[model samples]
Target: MATGWAGDGAVQDQIDATVEDAVKRARNQLKKGPGLTHCEECDAPIPAARREAVPGVRLCVACQSAHDEEAAFSGYNRRGSKDSQLR
Candidate 1:
């Protein structure tokens, strides 16, 4: 049922990459540094709820949203592969 580059490590690669990204992101999220403060970017109050919800959380909600908007990286499963060639 796959089509185009969808067949080139398509589903499996995407799934694997997703899992990998999740693991990496989870690792980063789990990492905690000394902190209890406001958002450096927007000076918004870092809610206790958010600090608790995300252990090492930085950036308030608004700042986080804006940062996400500005983040330039693509998702983990975006491209097929460098070695892949369309034909």
Candidate 2:
């Protein structure tokens, strides 16, 4: 049944949209083809063990750590605040 002003399937549509967006983001992050032998950012040699452990790896430990730090601070919140809940 419809809730509030939205139609019957409105909540489901929102859920579907959120899932689709997450999948799209994940797919974009996935690496295709073989893993790089060197770090693309710092040009450091990516260890053989790393390459083997993580298929399609591109960055070395240092560069990957920096990249992870940057990504963590990218300010994209998957969930909004309670203000959004009031909607």
Candidate 3:
């Protein structure tokens, strides 16, 4: 538990902060307001079923898939691991 310069429970604190930040980011990203009939990014027609299924949806299936892929590879290292810090 001796973390040198860091206080007790510093690692846990960092983990908790990372989780909270991710939660906040996800909540903030939730689409709000009315759903768009056309994809905002590609101008493709958004299916009615999709619009109803996901309220406030702005992007079509393909565009949303691409966006999700980009988001998945954000490469954010919030844990502050020694290895990552060293690099």
| Worst ten in a row by lDDT for model 1 | 78-87
Q: Residue 21 of model 2: what lDDT?
A: 100
What would the per-residue lDDT of candidate 2 be over residues 1-87, giving only the tens digit for each residue? 539899889999999999999999998888766789989988988888888888799889998898899878844445877866676
Ranking by lDDT: 3, 2, 1
Candidate 1 ranges with C-alpha deviation above 4 Å:
1-29, 33-35, 72-87
The TM-score, computed over Cα atoms with residue i paired to residue i, of candidate 1 is: 0.48
Clashing pairs in 1: none
* TM-score per candidate, chains pooled: 0.48, 0.51, 0.55
Candidate 3 C-alpha RMSD relative to the actual structure: 7.2
Candidate 1, 20: how far from true, in Å? 8.4
- Residue-level lDDT tens digits of model 1 in 6-73: 67668888899999999999897674864457888778789887888777777888878878887966
Worst 10 residues of 3 by lDDT: 71-80
TM-score of model 2 vs. true structure: 0.51
**lDDT agreement of model 3 with the native:** 0.91
Q: Return whichever of 2 and 3 wins on TM-score.
A: 3
| Candidate 2 error regions (>4 Å) | 1-29, 74-87
